[model samples]
Target: MAWYATGTVAVTNGSNVVTGTGTQFITNIKSGDIFIALDNGLLYEVDQIVSATQLTLKREYAGVTNASAVYEIVPTTSNLKTLAQQVTDLIAIYQEIPQSATDAQDAAAAAQGYRDTAKTYQDNAAASASTASGAATTAQGYRDTAKTYQDNAAASASAAATSKSGADTAKSGADSAKAAADASAALAGNWAAQASGTVDGANYSAKYYAMQAAASAASIALPVPITSGGTGATTAAAARTALGVPAIASSNTFSASQTISYSQPLFSINDTSGTGVAVLQFNSNGSMVWQLQKTSASDLNVRRYVSGAFVDVPLSVSNSTGVATLAQRPMFGTATPWDSANLPSVSGRLLNIQVFTSSGTYTPTAGTTKVIVKSVGGGGAGGSTAATSAGQSAVGAGGSSAGYAEVLLTAGFSGVTVTVGAGGTPGAAGANSGNAGGTTSFGTIISCPGGSGGAGGNPSAAAAVNPSAGVVAPTISSGTIINALAGQPAPNALVLVPGSVAISGYGGSGPLGVGGQGRQTTGAGIVGAGYGVGGAGATTSASGAAQIGGAGRQGVLIVYEFA
Candidate 1:
């Protein structure tokens, strides 16, 4: 039959027995059939079929024991046989073949013929060896003759190379002698060309030019002409007049009120040391009217004569950086100069800050005339849930955030009483609601109310339960409140069946603070962050275990004083 895999089988390690649970081995299996275990993909030959649910393998099972595993039974065919039996059958078939006397005689005749052919080949090989010996002797004599010829050829080649080397040496010597002769002839021709020039010609000899230069240097003319790059005068004053330029003097005194004018720079004063000062002065009737001076390498100053001495002007300039510094402030576009006390101060400058975390008094700083006050009420705490049994869960709702208020106080503001609100207390574990927060006030000028607490959750055993409701926004009341904002409400809590995830509610947010986070699994609630922020709710899934809710944050008041 075809391969049979009707049901699963179980086999043990190092055991030859296989047990089938839902299989029919006795009807489908036999000896020599292949047994295949699907779990380890191993095959074994079936040794015996014990029953409809059991069989035996030829060898022990190699793989680990499997209680239930798929298997296949491949039935043996008639063509299949053992290796030893096939070899025994082949030998029996060979023995059945018979031999005769005539066949034996034919075989002996063939052996005799082969022996005679081998003898003939041996005789022919001996004759060839003798011929090879004779040929080797002749080859040796020829080799000796060729060796003598090679020696004679080598000697002749050596003599020819010696002669070629000598000839090359002679040629090199002749080339050097010719080069020397040519150089000497070129030197003699250059000397003859140089000496051929006469003293009166344009191209004169070097010695002739040297003698002429010596004679000219012996005596120069007393008054050199200007065209020849000379001053054309012997004295300094005469030279100045001839050159059409003024004479220079270290110091001069004029009695006739003389005036000097020039189209270019009249005079230049240079300092060897960089730190030296240079001054230019203007005089009227021998009294200095104004003076300009370079005080340093980078600084310049201008002064006007006053009384008996020169007083500094209010203007100065830096030559290096090109920056100008004015001693006095300049008036712009016909505008009057500003008085020291009437000048405008910087805008939005902060002078001081006052903070109130509890009930206290607020006094303005010495120079504070205006103040900005901000106030916020306290936040409510989260609710707590009771202990839950198996297959039941309890969750609490988050609390609501507080309200915020801001106002500006000016002019008549003075010492005022301040009140900071305290945060609400969280409810104890075991199904309790949280307390409400307190109100904050800034001397009746600004006031804000606190948020409401969250409600506790009831135990639920269904797949899902409705979440707790969120709190409403708190109210704010005050005088001329510039910014009055209502805080955000709490988020809803989620309740789910047993073995599923459940979540607690998250707190609300305020103007200046953030709310607390929600809880998952089983844990206590998280506390609120910063001022006027709500607390987180508690959640639990453990049997007979209750969790506490988070606490709320306190309120705060701030005052910003400006000049």
Candidate 2:
């Protein structure tokens, strides 16, 4: 039967014979085995084995050297006809040529025996030929399988190369993004740790820290009416008390109202200088016409801000209390009305003014006189720098502070709720933005909401002091001097009812003190300082690393009582 097999490719020189290494199928070939190259299907014979990886060929090979060649061996065949002919000749020679009948007969019998043996040999040769044909068919199947495997291997190699290229590109992009985040974080600092704990076992209220404005007070949501602080609580009252809010008054408070007659030194002294008066009466007709005048002993004189300048005019004073002639009220202040120096002496005041940093109660000293209350709400968190820029740096501005003021004789008894606002925090150096401050109130009378938080150099609808802004803007119900819009930007202050003279010293700047604006590549701006000022946005450079924004400031409260 024919024999054939395959082997793994190996190194070779351009010679008549090729060598291979694998399951040793080629080693089984005999002297007559034939070899065929899988690479080109060139054929050759395996004449002999030199070593495990070497072999000799029957003739000088004509094909290119292929170490992976396979070979087939033709089955051997034997014939007896030729041998019988020689044996018959020998038998004839042995017989006597002269005429011995017995000898001649013996020679003929030996010739017949040789002919039968030769016939047997020829039959065997035919059977071997049929078997070789079957063997060749099987070798053909093996060659086809090896060819398919080689084709698949080539395709796999190509795919692997493409995948490696894509992976390299992805790695490069990731590295650039991480570098940007690291730069911003260096500036943002890990305020997350700063916010939740303090080394001195104290809150920021009475302490000092540079980052206090940059870091936020970590919130520990508390239960209402909470006894003290630890882990968790149950009610809103507990949370309020935990933040230092006064305990809810037992049995509720009484409600009543009365109009305190307005009378002052302006009526008694009657200053004659009419420049920069405290009040400029606003008319519903849209003209800024109201001005004050100095009066004679009986009637007061008045001046008006007309066209563009102040103009002096005659006086007409009117009164409602029947006992007196025309009683006049001071329309404007010599400077700012609430100017601490211009205030009445302590002897004339009911006085129960106290400052609460966190929260407590507003008792008013069991007053028989009226009390003046002023408050500023907490500022918003500073904006944050993004980990990576999606076209532009995403660093936001800081929020503005909220403010409110009112005069309460006995009116604010039910007002003045708790929870003094804490300043906002600097957002993490990533997509994260600034945190918002809390709401503060004098009950129903004064609701000074906290400033809205800032974004990462993105536009935000929550403006710090836009009158339409939810809470950061300031407002007042009493004295003209109290309507100061703290925290507003220069010339853009949020004034309540534009007066001849706007309230001064009201706003304290702070929210992003205006993010770095000179250069596009600058980092975030410093936080605002006083009231209502929004934080500046962050700056981005075409070539520099990302920067972070600043933190928002805290809120405040003040009260003045007059006896």
What ranges in model 2 sit over 4 Å off? 1-352, 366-368, 387-395, 414-416, 458-521, 531-533
Q: Residue 476 of model 1: what lDDT?
A: 39
Give all candidates' CA lDDT scores.
0.64, 0.42
Clashes of each: 0, 63
Q: What overall lDDT, based on C-alpha atoms, would model 1 receive against the true structure? A: 0.64
Q: Which candidate should be chosen as best, given TM-score against the real structure?
A: 1
TM-score of each: 0.41, 0.29
Find the 10 residues in a row with the least total lDDT in model 1: 93-102
Q: TM-score of model 1 relative to the true fold?
A: 0.41
Residue 356 miss distance in model 2 (angstroms): 2.1
Candidate 2 residue 431 Cα shift, in angstroms, is 3.9
Q: What local lDDT does model 1 show for residue 547?
A: 81
lDDT leader: 1
